[model samples]
Target: MSVYDDYEMTIGIECHVQLATKTKLFSPADNDARDAEPNTKTHQIDFGLPGMLPVLNKHAVELAVRAGKALNSPIAHVSRFDRKHYFYPDLPKGYQTSQMYNPIILAGYVDAPLEDGSLKRVRIDHAHMEEDAGKLTHHDGYSLVDLNRAGTPLIEIVSEPDMHSAEEAKAYVSELHKLMVYAGVTYGNLYHGNMRFDVNISVAKKGATELGKRAEIKNLNSFRSVERAAEYEFKRQVDILERGEEVVQETRGWNDDKQITISQRSKEDAQDYRYMPDPDIPPVVLTDEVIAGIQSKVPMLPGEYREKWSALNLDKSVINSLLSNQDYAQITLEVQEKSGEASAKRVAHWFASALTASDNDTNDDSTQTMLYAARGS
Candidate 1:
């Protein structure tokens, strides 16, 4: 039997997404911290002032509901915020306001594509709303805190341990990222840390009923890192098992430079965080009319766009490029509407070429305007 026959890997991922809201989750401070100076976007509420109160952002909730719809998840009409106590320099409040017992989004699954051209449905355990902590930058011997991100809105999507391979893990995150971005829940920018993935991996004997000790790789910023880290851990754990060694249950960090996982600390359970219902913030009560309104505003997702563009018989790359970008997809639809169905193929080619020439600059309003003019011409 092959060495691989002796072991199987089980993987689950926790994805943290920064909501695309204009203000912080519980404060009126600006939420977009991309290029702003450190700590400049913070407010008194973000700093955990004694008298400051937590106010939920309505836009953030609407975006969360939109995301739930996109994920095929049921949205809870009544969701409450709790306080998760923790101590760190990045967290000024000592406790983060989050949803624990009742999350906004319920169980859902993402149909992720595999490398073998097959689909696997990854079940989502839950998606909970929370406030993000600050950023800590370490200098030579000191560290500085940036509270700009402290009160930012975040949704942590926890997945069931259904993925068995690195490809599945990558695909699951990729699909999740696409859905969140297309649904306008988040910008899904890895560079700005709009989304981060925490991968929990474990191994088992081919016919074992119970799973082996698992290690969580935290804060993986890219899909490639998730794949590589999973693969690396799989082999590492198998090797340990071969030597009659037990895998340690700990939290690890992905070393992109070394392409390996480094142990961070022993994993902590939920009780360690001291979760308690927050008395300051009231439970969010959503009426049927409000939920229906938000659902109505949900746009066509990437999967729908794919099905629509596939009928055009255009190249798969072209179809995917357009679907991956909202502006490109809008331009393609406009072209088909204004120039008739016959002009769609030529316009798709031109649009793909322009996208390539423009380096896929989605922020260029002028380029989009020109495309509209050309389609009308």
Candidate 2:
């Protein structure tokens, strides 16, 4: 047996999902900064100017409610925001406004399906609402800060350390992404930083009762990166333990080009941030009726669609392809409802064929319209 077989790795993930709202979390600035000029989409609140106060976005809260249902988690009847104090070049206020003590999403679990048809259940600790900081662009000798992304709404989903393997980590993140997208909480665009993941991983002896010190890999945008980073970190930790050395608890950055993780800085604890309740914003209080109204708007999720399509006995690959796009899944279900199982099965195969032919470009508007036309016929 390999030396690596003697150790086990534990992984937990924290995802920052940008809310698909028209305006920033606290400001009236445009939230869609893609291809926009720097600083043009920012507002005074984003810049932290004097006399500026943050106003909570109601739509963001509604989206969070929908996200709660998607995760099988309960929403807090009353949630408050706290200021996480930190210093960074991109932070204009020198602190980030976030939900610390009372997060909006409570305990929940996700049953991620592995490739071998087995399920790995991962627990979610909580998810909190926060505002994103500005972007920093570095040059040879200087750095520029663009506040366009500052004050953008975000819900940070924190998962428990339940995942053991890198593949399990990848599956969990993939399932989480689908949940958010199908719930209409975020746009789920990885390229544009709509959903970013921070993986906290540690390794220990197989029979050890306690988990070893963990190093966090931050701001990974792709599911593959999460798996690769976890695998690399696990081996690195094992090597350290094998050499009679201690692994340092620090924050690391993934070098996608080099395919390695680089140490950024020592990870800070909660006391370091000196969390305090924000006076500018009031606590978010929701009634049962409000939550029911918001969550009722969440349409069918991926699992529901899978259960509905199981009766057709289509190939697993075809079902997976249909689930990749929300519109495709909705169209297939509509066809099933309108015509019959046979029609729905044929439409699903056609969509699968079309997706393969186009190389998985499901964003073609004209082509999507034609596919929707198939539902009617």
Candidate 3:
């Protein structure tokens, strides 16, 4: 007899995390590689050079598995890659390598805060490893494609349609972002396009087995967009239903400038993309020992860190700043290790002040940067 009596909103998310690797997923371009000129970073394999062999990036696999464990997803002993066939200027190979049938991480949950001071569990369906497509820059009259990102390693974490409200969906994304930040998955800087999310939303009557029509909002780079887009869609669809109109299933693009979701195409009109196994790459067979070892390598994560720090009732501002950046979390832990747990809060306060305040290459640079590095050292 709550809000459920009026409506039910089901939600799912697909979050793409770029691996912070020293090199590209398959090629040798530096991690977070950027090229000013189009197709400048191209390698034969990256350029879809004929008969080129792909050697799996060892670090990419390990980081994917490690992050999967942090998400509490079961490790798949064997995972395979698929060819998602599509044609776009940004796609150098005319296809993308991703996991479709089976993924690296199976099932998990991300706990999120609720409006009632309770917790809502965001169900994670799977987290799969894949390669990112290139970036397309559109000019006034033409478009150019940059291949530097063509082969970058990306881990796509998908969630079940378990969320019931826009707020819940936002918290879910924010929590996952935090977990990724702490685990070194990616920088989660939407402004820089380091991490991005796609939201799938559907609204239904309070009691209904059949779901209402759905719309997909693509590449929402910011957490605010994720929530606002969902809320906007919910209202738009609900209004349609109230007017006794049929809501068609379709994919849409977010017009960030207008703060609205615009239809790209009806779902049925979209291409199949003809998924098939990649003929070039071999199946990923992860042994049990390797899985366990990778799991062991992940230290206590954000949830655990939060629990341990709660006893001190630390300042919310300090906690917010610490959680804002994963690097700060790591620094806090290191400072605690060196200064002792009893004095951890005091050390963290000073560190947070410096990190949030100053810039590099100034008078306070050497000493503060050393204090920052000393925690890790």
> Over the stretch 163-200, how does candidate 3's per-residue lDDT look in tens digits?
98889988888888878866767766666677889899
TM-score computed on alpha carbons, candidate 1: 0.93
Model 3 TM-score, all chains together? 0.87
lDDT of 1 at 83: 94
Worst 10 residues of 3 by lDDT: 355-364
Give candidate 3 regions above 4 Å deviation: 1-5, 139-141, 268-271, 315-317, 331-342, 347-377
Indicate which candidate wins on TM-score. 2
Encode model 1's per-residue lDDT on 165-214: one tens digit a residue: 99999989988998998888998888789999999999999889999999
Instruction: Give the TM-scores of the predictions, in the order they appear.
Output: 0.93, 0.97, 0.87
The lDDT-based order of candidates, best leading, equals: 2, 1, 3
Clashes of each: 0, 0, 0
Candidate 2 residues 269-355, lDDT tens each? 989999999999999999999999999999999889988988999887898788888888898999999899999998998888867
Residue 174, model 3: lDDT of: 81
Q: List the residue pairs that clash in candidate 3.
A: none
Per-candidate Cα lDDT values, in order, are 0.87, 0.92, 0.78
Best by lDDT: 2
Model 1 shows how many backbone clashes? 0
**How far does residue 284 in candidate 3 sit from its true spot (Å)?**
1.1
